[model samples]
Target: MYYIAHRLFAAHDRALGALIARQLAKKAGPESVFLPFCDTDEEDLVAPVKGHRLFELDRERLQTLTGMIAVLHGPSLDDGVCMEIGYAAALNVPVVVVTTDFQTYSADEHSPHWAFPDPLIETIAHRVTRVDRLGAPQLADSPDRFTAFAARNQAQIETAAAMSVEAILELAANNCPAPAPARAEAGTVFLEPSPHIRCPEALLDTLHAAHRSVTIAIRHQAPDPFTAAHADWTTALRAEVLVADVSGPETPPGGAVLIGAAAALRRRIAAHLPTAVITHAHGREPNWRNLMIQYAVGTRVCDAHSLARWLAS
Candidate 1:
């Protein structure tokens, strides 16, 4: 039997979680069940009252579950959700993270408001899926507009839920093999573009003229940037240069815990890939945290013009 684990905390989360569960349950075969964390009725509200019983029940469910799906949004990771993910990982349950917020780092006035997930959460999940919001008329404008908005939101949620179910099933089948090492040719450069950089086309042309094979890896807010970096670092068959854009400092949602968590993730990545970050002096000055990152990673601080010249050289 395949048991799927899920967490739903807030009122809206519970409503959405119930919708996902219902959809999964509808598609479930005789051998599969989508078990949500709220399925239990042991309500203590206060800690250490019925906490032991609650823990025991949750632990059993997690231990017996086939896989876990976590919904991560908002400013910080929920303590209970984190515990569930940790428990699932400890028991060798494959985990998938579904995130709703994604923000691009850029000074462009026309850019969309994308909220990146906590980097710590990004690092843990086996797979990360992004659920983008729908583009509909304002809910407060008219009846038709409100109806359209509601319908679009529902459709997007259902689509995300379906994708999660498919991922769980795929993991159970175990048909996917580990990704093979990327074969790097001589003079190959992996360019990671961010919204903060100006005119990457010219830079690309310069590298091309120098007989360098350039591969652009666009950064998605869902997956851990460090995870991708580590994979490329360890598994690339040939030597290649990673050119990462050091755009600006992150503005995490207001809270010390979140700020500290984001900082820790940045430091960890910098330590892992010290040479990947490329500083553009024309952009915002590397904030104190970013400076620490550059220093720790041992990345050379250079302007765009200098970087282009160096790449050509």
Candidate 2:
């Protein structure tokens, strides 16, 4: 049994959710049973008169699921979806989290922070698939925003749906084993600091002395330093290694400054430079920024001192 977990609180969400579920079901083969939360009529599970019963039914459904695909979007994880993911994890059901939004939120005076999908879900997901939000304009006054949005982004949406079905099939075939975690590589590291925070001078001196060519891409948010020395050091230089510092902005939205910068840098220097991201150690849950950076750069490191030591060695 394949389970589709997503938000259907709004009509727009439900429309898109139904389309995704349909595509998955069509591709998942006839023998595969699809249990989308939105299909209350087909699944014989309606929104309960009492909220507790809804969870009870959901738990029952999760136990019977062999594989699951979840849609993750917006700024945070929906509370109900988070609970469902936990349930699936406890049941050892393989889960694929499909992130449908990649565009950064427009920053304004009222909201300086970036919107990111919840790190917890990003961590727990057995596999993560991203669909770049093709340049679909937000239509505030459209009578059916979801339909309009789907029309505009049909190609990308279908691509994501295909990938979701493939992941579901793979999970079912594998009997729901957790995917192996990515291993971090050791090399000359590219250290990217969060917006506004400068790389420590001691770190820079050590990097220079260690024979590693380092390029520091300053955040657009920070005031450009005036000195020639600063200019020389901050200029983007090509190297065999790229290390991003993902320490700042506690909650950066999708397309966080470092993530965007690293992605651009990767594209520009990918033929020569392999990239790595350095982040502060948090709990085991993967940071959304870290995940994005990992997607851009092939390597990631959590311990700054350890990475520096490795560079020195």
The model with the greatest lDDT is 2
Clashing pairs in 2: 114-253, 115-253, 190-242, 190-243, 191-243, 192-244, 192-245
Candidate 1 on 135-235: residue-level lDDT in tens?
Answer: 45454554676687777787677777778867766775683443433344567665544433353565567657767676654333324455543443332
The residue-level lDDT of candidate 1 at 243 comes to 52
User: Which 10 successive residues of model 1 have the least lDDT summed?
Assistant: 251-260
Q: How does each model score on TM-score?
A: 0.48, 0.46
Q: List the residue pairs that clash in candidate 1.
A: 102-114, 102-115, 103-114, 103-115, 274-297
Tens-place lDDT per residue, model 2, 69-173, is 877676654434444564565345788877678743423445323323323244346787787766366555656878667666876777787888788778778
Model 2 spans > 4 angstroms off: 29-31, 34-38, 42-49, 103-116, 135-150, 176-313
Superposed by TM-score, candidate 2 places the C-alpha of residue 43 at a distance from the truth, in angstroms, of 12
The 0-to-1 C-alpha lDDT of every candidate, in the order given, reads: 0.47, 0.50
> 84 in model 1: Cα distance from truth in Å?
1.4
